[model samples]
Target: MQKTNNLGSIKRLQREYAAFLKSPPPDMTIYLIESSVYECHFSFKGPSETDFAEGIYHGKFIFPYDYPKNPPEVYFFTPNGRFAINTKICLSITSFHPETWTPVWSISSMLEAIRAFMLTPAAGAVGGLESHSDVKKEFAKKSQYYTCPVCGANHQELKKIFLLENDKKNLTENIEHQLKINTSSTEVTSKLSNYDKTEYKLENVEKDHKIIIEKENNNNQQQDIIKEENDIITQNEINNECKEELLTKIENDEINKETKEKEEEINQEDDVLTILKKRQEAEKEKIKHFLENKEEIKEETERNEKYTVINETINIIFYLSIFLIILMVLNLLKIKIIMYFLN
Candidate 1:
């Protein structure tokens, strides 16, 4: 079911597009590019004797992917005009086209809407009308005479086409209405001039305001980007500092470990020295004891030798005793002589 509807939509678009190509509207020059079927460029002259009369303007009309189902977007190419670029123009027919656009209304009807909409002001619209009466009038003069490059025809062809295609009663009435006109031409012109001046001033002020807003937005975006970049740089610097500190700490730890090991080794050497000093003191005590025992042995051996000699001499000693006593008495007498010798 969906496929069938899709095919139907395709057929309708193709049919509408074919009809438009077969007979394009008069006065407007349309150029269709082969690559994009929905996009077209057009050139048209402003309406005659009016403010936008003589200007040769270029514009673009872009059909959405949906084409005739939705209204095509229209935008002016030239900047030297009252209306802004790509500003949407409102028309009763165009607005209602989505629901009420019949196959019966040809491309010519749409073109008429374009023309009429350009003449009217689109208040509060982006790229809306802003030209002075004098400016529009001057542009209108040139618009009427300019030739459409695509069609190789002038705008007079358009005016003739409009006169022929439009309601005959309105046209005939408009001519008679001109004859019966009561409003002074100068008064209307003066009033139009004032209106144009006011409109132009407001539109120009709006344009300036929009430009300032766009510029401020761009500056804010740039500042945000710069701030982000600065933050990233600051974070990177902090990370680098942390990494450096960690490396230094690691190196210091290694040095401390080496110092600790060396201190431990020195302590072990001091323990070994203390053990050697205790062994040396024990050896010296043993040597001193051996020397004292040898002295005692010599004294005992001398006493034994004196006992044997006394026994052998006992008999002889009896007779010698008396002699010894006399010798002792003589020695006692000689004591005074010994003492003198000693002194």
Candidate 2:
């Protein structure tokens, strides 16, 4: 369950890991954590002709849940001679504003950006040191330190794993020839470019020996890169497996939540139907009682009407008999009074 909750974060980390693994930068190296893609460590060699030449530095990268959409956080484990200690550099891709980050840029590009931007003198920026050019050149000459706080090894020892020496003479000759050709085209002024070239070649006797040494060093470095790449791949596989497991768990949790919601909806529907059925039965019983009472009331009203008609007829007959008796008595009294008057 805990793993499932971290699915999105895991997936995001995996994507970044895959990208870094598939297309690694020549100047920078990375290794994944044992069980997590989101957290990995990286080591970067300073670019040539810079103050950090021959200097090695290490840093950590941490991705958030909404990565790509949001940039990750990057911090140096070792202090850069110019930058502040453990300061977060504001990168276009990994900054608070993601809209400014370009899709074309990759981890290599980010590293390049760091190299380019670290020399700026921005006040609010972290890790910017102001040193003289001569001082910087001196530091660059002897920058190899044996102890790495982050990787726990000397830069040369660590780099020994990926060293590859191509042909040094061929490489230097190619560079010198290109410089001569470029110089000739820029200006036709005095044959100064040709003169300088001849003078350099004559004065430099130990050139061949230096070339051999450089060639050997390059070969060693290339070999180290290959070995480190292999190690990174191995670690990335472990990270991917762990991430897959986490995503699967999350999917299951989502399914369970949906199922619970559906069951609750069904239960509510059942309750509503039950209430409606009860209401219908109660309505039916009330109608039945109303019909029975209406019929009984109608019967009582008919019986009362019949009794009232009979009482009215008996009263009328008794009154008519009393009036006939009074008439007969009055006629007899009148006849007696007239006879007494005549006598």
Candidate 3:
């Protein structure tokens, strides 16, 4: 079973590679690496009108044995500012996000996705860089002459060869398509000529003459009917003009009345808005006054607390002084009593 799957993968890869060579994607070319079907080298020119423009970048793709059942590893060997050199970049189409891979996706689609991703921000994705635009532009200038070490081919030279081959293929296709169209038209013309060679008899000629006479009479009757219709249309047009004038006058009157009503409503709305503004201002002033009064009350309470604390501290100090003098007086009395007893 595994061998069968491997064969299937190789076959699929061979088909895709052949198709890519037959009609390569715009601005890109792929080459098999070391003659291995599972590994390929690709190079593409930068998208026009971008920082990466004027640059050609080279990259490598390594396909797993499971092939389309799994995604390919994508790495850029070129020193493009958007991705690290020789590092596998994280992208939905890359091996980093295999869940998004599908068998329907081809090498062309992968190249398109990579090209589009180059123009986006790095956003901290693995192997992505946020290089300055100036730096990227410098790299773009140098990239034109860059040769891939692995591929051993100049980027611009490869691009030229691819463009030449693609142009030849497209021109051939156009020529073949035109030839097909011409052949079909020639066949149709030959068929029509053969159809026109049918024999006609005298009875057919007589029937054709009768048809012409009947057609001429019908045309004369239609002309007369058309003249009558024109007369009726002119009369209806005159009626419509009068009706239109009356409608215009009525519409003008209604429009003037509507304008007057709209103006009155606008004036009423302006007056209401002014009143609301005045009320808002009054409310704001009230709030401001209340806040000021609250602040003043807070300050007064703070001041009172401070004064009470200072008064308490002073009273305690005065009591301590009086108690110390009483102690001194008692000591002096005791000394005098001793002297008297000794005498």
Candidate 4:
């Protein structure tokens, strides 16, 4: 399992290397160790914009088992007169401080930070050895002709190759940009036609939505009269879920803000998708309950209609029997009166 995890880092390194080749750093050349990828060598040009300008610096990068998570140990191989040769350069991005290391910080990032740090006065610290400015300038002059035995290339040659690759990369980007512009021009007319069709569909959908909303809102209002108590309860649940989501997002935002501030030391990565997934799952359950409550309400409404119909039919029959009785009594009274008159 450990080996597999290490392999993940190695594979990632391989991909980073390929990407570096396509877009190589301006004044840095990195080469792999004999057969071990974990150890690599780099020749960096002293940033021309600084006092160390034009000084070629050779360095070694040694990776631990947990690379990326742990920044590599960087050591200067050449006596650039900045720090003692073969001395490790201590910076925030180095193995000197694992707490600040982040997997997202690649080898190029490390080199860039180191290059910037080299411009600072060394002060003869544990990892930094300060030197005279004139001596450093002389070293810069000498750095131009320095060659690495392992890489078998001089500084200028490496710099030439890097610039060529950079130009090619830039040219490729320009070509891609032009292709996009050309493709967009052709797509413009089609997109305009598509926009018209979509506009028609959008109007239709909006009308449909209004109709559906009106119908549902009307039905729900009527149901409120019938099952006002139950609907109020279910509606509260839905409102609570919405309120909870709103509050949760606000709280998460606060937490994220705090986390960002605090975790700067750790450089932790957050899984935003995971957070969203959890919230979505919770809301789905609430929706399921809401729908279930609606179904129950509908079933109850059907039962109520059936009961009302049966009661109305019984009331109608009772009234008809009472009218027949009253008519019979009146007819009997009329017959008795006629008999009395005859007697």
Task: Specify the highest-TM-score model's number.
Answer: 3
Instruction: Estimate, for each residue in 5-108, the C-alpha lDDT of model 2 and write its tens digit.
Output: 24565555566556765666665666555434455677767666677766666776676554554567777655555655477666555665477865455556
lDDT of 3 by residue, 73-126 (tens): 999887889999888899988889988888899998999989999998899999
Rank by lDDT, highest first.
3, 4, 2, 1
The true-versus-predicted C-alpha distance at residue 88 of model 4, in Å, is: 2.2
> Where is model 4 more than 4 Å wrong at Cα?
1-5, 159-343
Residue runs of model 3 more than 4 Å from their true location after superposition: 1-5, 162-343
lDDT of each: 0.59, 0.63, 0.77, 0.70
Which has the higher lDDT value, candidate number 1 or candidate number 3?
3
Candidate 2: 10-residue stretch with minimal lDDT: 161-170
All candidates: CA RMSD in angstroms? 35.9, 14.9, 27.5, 40.9
Worst 10 residues of 4 by lDDT: 242-251
Query: Model 1, residue 44: what's the lDDT?
Result: 58
Query: What are the runs in model 1 whose C-alpha is more than 4 Å off?
Result: 1-14, 86-106, 140-343
Which candidate, 1 or 4, would have the higher TM-score against the true structure?
4
Listed in order, each prediction's TM-score against the native is: 0.35, 0.45, 0.47, 0.45
Candidate 1, residue 105: Cα displacement in angstroms equals 5.3
The TM-score that candidate 3 achieves is 0.47
What's the residue-level lDDT of 203 in candidate 1? 62
Pairs clashing within candidate 4: none
